[model samples]
Target: MRVVLTTWGSRGDVEPLAGLAVALRGLGAETVVCAPGDDDFVELLARAGVAHMPLGPTVRSVVAGPKPPGAAAAFKLAPELVAARFETLARAAEDGCDAILATGLMPAGARDVADKLGVRYVLACFHLLGLPSQFSAPGRRPGTPSPEGETDNRKLWQQDAERVNALYGPALNEHRAAIGLPPVDNVRDYVFTGSPWLAADPVLLPSEGMTDLDVVQTGAWILPDDRPLPDGLEAFLDAGAPPVYVGFGSMAAYAPKDIAGVAIEAARKHGRRVVLASGWAGLSAIDDGGDCFVVGEVNQQALFRRVAAVVHHGGAGTTTTSARAGVAQVVVPQIADQPSWAARTAELGIGVAHEGSTPTVDSLSAALATALDPQMRARAEAVATTIRPDGAAVAARMLLDGASAAA
Candidate 1:
């Protein structure tokens, strides 16, 4: 069977799909990794030995550039944002895959192709972005919206239903009409994984407004076991009591040098060593930095094991990694779901969430000190032990089962 998986976003988004592809491959499925429009990520996939098909340059332009002015008001202005993705997915669907899977970002395109081919497709989500049931995690009230202002659970549920209807509803009908297949009545025709409603086994997840059935918690898609650690990472491990790992993936520091200086000072204040991830985002070193090392990408899994504390922008991938690593953290959330993850971390006793706006040296120093506390460290590790590896094999089996059931 052939499984075509589609997704979009940054490395965090693309890399997990890669894990899914590898998992599907192990299940004896010929996998085709199709992402909306990210030529930039093509090399990374190639390096990982994954087959890929890029959608279109226009999709790339839209995702990479700033959101079109007033996109919220005029969806037409951002055709590529919601509408033009079908053209890209359709172009890819001509190959005639057996099953298509889509991430939350590009469901329309996946739905269009699945309807055309009369094949089954599934929607996989890494997190409960705005789903109704997602609000039940902890500080949630029924019928109330997320306190974060991005969405209210009540409004988001209605909006999600409407968004799917207005965006994917018509495209799917047109594709079905051309292919002589009847249109679906509701958006639920597309199967969903990682939501609680359809999960075979109960997992700890929010339980408020979630309504979709046919859901399965495929576990968190994470890096495979074979990804080798970066060279010389061992030296850093030996340098001191596992240093605090700090670096915001993809988000460039406004002033790496200044940030580095501040970070070094903070680490010194807390009497800890620091390993700064020197990624595309410029992160500099401190002027007084004696032993602080600014290095490039290291195997996150391997590196996380060697760290006592993790300080990062609360990305989903990073949050899972830190939790699984059993390390305390000082979360300095930048935007979007980062704050949510940060807040969750603090509430769960993984560590203290940095308060206020931008992460300053003084605040970071204090957070780091708290994270290093013995009780906090023990709690974080205990939580990590419970964070069962969302087994890749299980998710792989589910994908294969979906295809086999369709047959």
Candidate 2:
């Protein structure tokens, strides 16, 4: 069987699909990934031994570019990108594919491609909040009004749908028209099928209040990481008690103005060493101290196991990785589904959610102190033991089984 897994946005968006692609390959299925042409994504897919077909420029170029465009400017380019995405995925699956699975925004194009080829299109989501749930709120935008009661939440969701429609609906319909497909009335409903697969660790995140949405929770799509830590990092880990691991994976727009001093000071207050990841923000150690270590992208699955606690931007991938490693966490959420992840972490008693994105030395120290507590660490370890590691395999089997049944 052959599969094409397409994704966009940050590394977090690409990693899960890459894991699924690897799992498909392991089951003797040819898999190709359509992702952004970012070098980081290229390196990640290469390491996983998956075939990568670039769709367009990486999110880095658009978000962190020297002349980053405003919302209106970026929206102006959406139609072309939507059209390009449809063209790219169609080509990737031209050789005949069993399934085309897509995640991230603008999946309607992928759906159209699948319709054109008479193949099944599988829509997968990493965050549970993306789906409609009376229990939880929708993925919050940067400055939207918070919903109050159940009625308010429902209205908020409807409002959110309107926002999505106004933003991407026109472009989506334009592409559909170009391909002789009928325009969709509800963009959100069109992208989110009647049933969508939820790729998240069930132990850490479970679907609730799923009214009309029949979500298939296939656990988190996590790739097994065997890459050894860099020599310098390994030496640092060997030299001291596991440091408090701090890194906001790939939140380019989540610019926490002074994360360096805040995180380092907070960790130091707890008498813990620090391992700082210089993500897109270019965070670095402020002082020349041997107790601190600075690093670029490394293996979180391996590194989290050695850390005393994990502090991050509460991305789905990072949250799951830290939970699986059985380490306590402190999540400083900036936007989107991050606040939800942070809330879940705190609810599970395995971590503390920093009040807001910008953390002061004292605020982060308090959060770290809570996470460093022995009881919380114990709960994290217990939860880790229950986290299933076969989400990719389960999803792969489901795809192949569907193809077999159809045949």
Candidate maximizing lDDT: 2
Query: Against the unseen true structure, what C-alpha lDDT does each candidate score?
Result: 0.64, 0.84
- lDDT tens string, model 1, 203-252? 22332345433345656776565566655666757867778788877554
Model 1 alpha-carbon drift over 4 Å, by segment: 36-40, 56-78, 81-85, 104-106, 133-156, 159-214, 225-228, 252-261, 286-288
TM-score of each: 0.79, 0.94
Instruction: Kindly list the per-residue Cα lDDT of model 2 for residues 46-85, writing each as its tens digit.
Output: 9999999998667787777534356664565565567767
lDDT at position 291, candidate 2: 83
Whose TM-score is greatest here? 2
Cα error, candidate 1, residue 167 (Å) = 6.8
Candidate 2 local lDDT, residue 235: 95
lDDT of 2: 0.84
lDDT of 1: 0.64
Q: Model 2: how large is the Cα RMSD against the reference? A: 2.4
